[model samples]
Target chain A: MPSSEEVFEKVQAALMDALGVDDDEVTPEATMVGDLGAESIDFLDIVFKLEKAFGINIPREELFPDDILTNSSYVKDGTVTADGISELKARLPWADLSKFEKNPRVQNFGNLLTVNDLCRYVESKL
Target chain B: MRWFWIDRFEEFVVGKQATALKNVTYSEEPIDDYLPGRPHYPHSLIIEGMAQTGGILIAQMQDFHPKVVLAKIGKAEFNSIVVPGDQLRMTAKLMSLQSDGAIIEGHVTVNHQPLAEMELAFGILDDSFGDTSFFLPGGFFRILRSLRLFEVARHEDGSPIQIPDYMLEAVRQEAAQ
Candidate 1:
């Protein structure tokens, strides 16, 4: 199994290649969409690169829980409900959802994924 | 005025790699018109040629089921200018293939010299994009036939890649019409 640092490096490289961002810009705290300027399509490219780098199969839902976020049962108005937050916490144990929990707007969810979260996810898989 | 950038498929391996050739000639309108006096092929068209080469390779993997579109050009680097009379050979290798998208690494060469390199991303559109078909049935197949894609294409097991029945049926329907 790769160490946490190694996993972070591989994830960083994947993000850099996928988003055309520099190494320093891919700091652990950087938000994928906010800091790296990743679009929705870029995630597919990132997933492909990460899979290749770590020799792991990343199911789309594990990284992007679009279904959960979009489902009416989990969302009220534009925000994710308390149950939705619980589901997100369960689905994305690797991600830090504390900050997002305060607002939990479905739109805000896209920008919540950080580089550190990605590394943790990769480490979880390993 | 066909949008075809590639002249012919020189090599094709299903779901793997493809190589196509484009012979530039001064007779082409773009050569003289693009740069006024200097008659070199536009880099944009070179990228288009690579996209076509790579796009078709990705499409064939799914028997052209998914509406494959070039979503991004991750990287494009031109080492030398291509002039008329230059025979450009473009090879695209499938680097990654997934349900939502794919990536291909492409290289363009002229006379055994590296001319350009590209990394392209292709997206497979789902039904949300609308149920309309992008091409008239059998239209793309006719172009593929003209390019001799079936003649050169082969599966990994070395078996010949046959034209999909739907495409053939479309051809027959068009012929009957």
Candidate 2:
């Protein structure tokens, strides 16, 4: 298993390659979409590069659990309830969602994800 | 006629992953049927090609005992245009496999440039549940042989897996024809 520092370095490299961002832009606090300018489609490239770098199979569901998103108990009328946010937090403990916690939206959670979140997730997998 | 979106698999592991190739030609029916004057592979067919690649890999992993069918294309995205003379290389990696179904992650590239990415789900067809035969035609094995699937395949521990009996039978049937 890699140290957390090593995982952070690798994760930064992956973000640079996937999003074509500069070194300064891929900070721990930088959000994937809002801060780093990652489009919805860039997540696939990020996942692919992360898998190659870590030599681990990260299931698509692991990135965003489909069952939670689709479950009626979590989502109601396209909005995520408090229960949904709690479940997402439990699953994605790596994310620093202090801002999202204030007012979370179902469609915008991807945007709320941060570079540090991915680094922590990959470290856990390793 | 036996219809296959992908021509043949070039590289494969029993259950883990696979790589296949498809050639886009002007003579093919879909290219012409999709648009009379403008000939380009449609996104839908491209997705089907990915699904077929992943579906067959899952089926082969189960040793072909249960018929595998494309249950859902959970996600698909095309990034570039594919036209005649383009050779698409599709790679499928198994994500999760259950007794009843599987989920696969796949990607396609042309000349090492990204073409598409896909998430495909497959269900095992059970005849006891009023299932019909969805097996690829016997000729599929002939194409598999030509592409060296059996020669290239291996398990995680680097040991070769025995060719399934049904595949052997398919080859025999193709030879008889």
Candidate 3:
């Protein structure tokens, strides 16, 4: 298994290619969407690149829980309910959802994924 | 105004790679209209040509059932300009394939000299896009026949690829109508 630094490097390169962002812009704190300007389509490209780079299979739901975010049972008045937060936490143990938990608007969820979170997820897979 | 950017398939391997030809000429309106005096093939059209070649390669893997569309261009780089009289050989190789989408690495060359290189992604549209079809029934099969895809196409096992029964059935239904 690659070290954490090596995993970050590969993840950074994947983001640079998938998002057309500069190396410096892919800092761990950078948000995948808001900071790097990644659209919904870009996630697919990123997944393809990461899978090739790491030689790991990434199920779509593991990284992008679109089904949970869109599920009516988990959302109320456009905000994720407390149960939704619990589900997200269970699904994404590597992600830092504390910030999102304060105001879990479904729209804000798109911008919640940070570069560090991605690195952690990749590490967990490794 | 036919939307065909590729003229013919020079080589085709099922679910693998395909090579197509596109000849640029001065008579085509885009050659002159795009830049007035440049008289060269637009890079966008070259990308489209590559996309079509790659799209067909992906579509054929599923017997052309999926509504394959060019979802994103990951990378495109042109090293030289292609003017009129240039016969471009565009090749697309399947790099990755999945149920939701596929990625192709494409290259364009003229006389063995590199012209452009690209990475393109194609998405398989699902039922959410609606039941509307992108083409009339059996329309694409006719287009494929005219492009001579089957003449050069073969399965990985070296067996010749045959038109799917559904396409032949659609053609018969259309002929009756």
Candidate 4:
């Protein structure tokens, strides 16, 4: 299996390729929709890439989060600490954490989580 | 085929107006995936079909060069379930289009009754495919199609929409004369 870092790189590359843009368009500090510019369909396309890259199925339920995957600062104090999903399920109700996979609208379809956040979460599981 | 997701085109002309049709059938695998005994059209697939039809209309204006990716579905309302043996009336209107992409409010209807509706957006999938190095058999398309996630009729309308002069010229130049 590939490392989470590798997976994140793949996801980032996928976004740039699918959206027909460059890495500059989706910087770590850029929001998926605002700064980088992604609508819902574009969002769905991104999800497909993540699923393919990790060879994993994204629980559909996490498709959309109200304030997730936004263009936010992930780097703090000369290191990358702040991230997207941090705001996605930050208020998780526990039991619903497992249910997050079933809701496609959660965290705005994992938009808040950079490839790094996603790899971090996935790595923690391993 | 691996790809990414982009955003709505602020200048997309289909802001809220479009017209087309969707011919449904039992052969669609997604129906069986959701309900075997009572096969019904999955809502997402329905939207994907409509988005394809709408995206094609938008792309035709560019003479099949511009790759318009469906960005989002906004304000979708479902009145009832769709199944095989249904001819859907699909329509989409441009709400806006950015230099990078566009957004359109779209929907489908059966027997003149609204079945599904949404505000959809589309963006350009960059030159990633051209790079080839990132290309891989992701198997994502197969899985998605199995669930009826995507269905594009193998046909070409061959009609071009009115586009800006430069785009038309570019397509003409690309055309094999």
Candidate 5:
């Protein structure tokens, strides 16, 4: 399988193909529905991308149902906040420990992480 | 929503089938941010729609308890991108099950044109360490039904299909003394 970064890039490319969007569009900040006008079909494409990229199962619950809710700040481990910013912090000083983590739309989609997020974790391990 | 509604189980007793519809609306919040007139429906939502179909049935299988988390997705194929205003008709059928997980086959079609579809295996996990959380009033099931979205149908003949005997056996978790 490709490295985590490679997998993310693959997902990015696949989503681009599925959405007919430019490569620059799929940033971490972009919500699948909110930022990309992605309906259910495009999302399914992303899952296919993620599954192929990472070699794992992404069940329905793996990806949060509502677009807005998936992007919003969530309480992780029932304590720490897991918005994107905090997500960056959580990775550096150890991936998780009460400090909330970004719940990747990454159910068993392999590694329980998004491309960039997985990259960060991989980097942290070094 | 992403999953397209096709039909509902009106005749089936144990097994049920349902359909969802996903219209790629131009006015969705995301389009405004994109440059020009580019628009498309996100893919994950489609699966959720299918999952909702499967999820609801799983809930029905489990008597709507111990919420079924999508345990696994197998062999998903994207025939094409689903766009706004495109009528996507989705269908889900009970495949198989075990004490730990279930397999359901679902597909997505737009104007009868196949777009994306997959055969999914979902697991009913305990509330601990799982995404398939039970009692999610705001979850997919409520949203789809309350909104009166999806054409709820159980079988191909506009009738409910009998629940697969094995699924009934697997779903019976309480164990009789």
Candidate 6:
């Protein structure tokens, strides 16, 4: 049971190791895809480094999850409905989405993921 | 006996994972027989390509001293079809490694589109299994050399892998010929 600070350090290190980015680019608010420039391919590399660094098994599905936006149960129109927002909130509790909650789009859900979110997820797993 | 599935490896990290790429071409013999009119790469062969990508990684993890065999395919699901002219990028990651064997999880994609996913298990045949020629055929080494696999491969800590003696011998012998 490592402290949150410890987890944050490991997470930052994993990101740096996987993406080869500078130390300054890995702030907690940095989004993996946006700020860190993580493509879909980098996700596997990131997960692998995290698993090795923390000695914890991180399933790919648990991290990004399936694109539930395509399923009718969550999305009725192009925009995410109340049910969809609830599902997103439940799935991504670590994300700070007060801004996203105002108007959520199915496609933009990926944008909500953040570096802090990853650290929080790791903490929860521990 | 002959390795044909894996064309080359793009990335290989010893004891960690590997990413290999195979090009599905109509010039291949199997394509002539598979689906007469609408030619498509066999899903089975695609899976085999993934197996080779992972199998080689698993074997190399232990320096290829033990015989590695595909014991089982725990799961494989094809999401889309692969046709000629498409390049398949297959990545295999070590799930678990133990004394007896190893488990690997693999995924294949074409131009970033998901093609298939698989979970494979491999058995490492130890010396007690009887007189086993763990050394691969000379031709296999030739293919590996052509692909420059050794040049790109690295240990988990990013250090260069010391090419095994038998492999070096085979390469040396093949080069002399």
**Candidate 4 residue runs with Cα over 4 Å from true position:** A1-126, B1-17, B128-177
lDDT of 5 by residue, B117-149 (tens): 687767666545565544443343444344353
Clashing pairs in 1: none
Highest lDDT against the true fold, candidate: 3
Between candidates 4 and 5, the one scoring higher on DockQ is: 4
lDDT of predicted model 5? 0.53
Per-residue CA lDDT of model 4 for A1-126, tens digit only, reads 677557556766877855667876655445555455665556555655565566665443444433333333532333223343345456332113333344433333434544344454444433
Error of 2 at A50 (Å): 19
* Residue B70 lDDT (model 2): 76
TM-score of predicted chain A against the true chain A, for each candidate:
0.97, 0.88, 0.97, 0.52, 0.47, 0.90
How far out, in Å, is residue B99 in model 3? 3.7
> What order do candidates take by lDDT, descending?
3, 1, 6, 2, 5, 4
Models sorted by DockQ, best on top: 1, 3, 4, 2, 5, 6
Docking class of 1: medium
DockQ of each: 0.57, 0.04, 0.51, 0.10, 0.03, 0.02
How far is B117's C-alpha from truth in model 2 (Å)?
A: 1.0
Regions of candidate 2 where Cα sits further than 4 Å from its true position: A1-126, B136-140, B166-177
In model 3, pairs of residues that clash are none
User: Which stretch of 10 consecutive residues in model 1 chain B shows the poorest summed lDDT?
Assistant: B131-140
Candidate 6 lDDT, B51-92, residue by residue in tens:
888888987876666677777665689988878899999999
Give per-model TM-scores.
0.90, 0.55, 0.89, 0.41, 0.43, 0.55
Q: Candidate 6, what DockQ?
A: 0.02
Cα lDDT, model 6, residue B91: 95
Q: What digit string (tens of lDDT, one per residue) describes model 2 on residues A4-65?
A: 88888888998887677998998998888899987644565677668879998777777766
Cα lDDT, model 5, residue A30:
56
Identify the CAPRI category of the predicted complex in candidate 4: incorrect
Write candidate 2's Cα lDDT for B1-177 as tens digits: 346678777888888898988888887887878877888888888778777778878877766557877776656888887789999999999976655567688889987899888877676666765755555646556666666677777888888767777778876877899
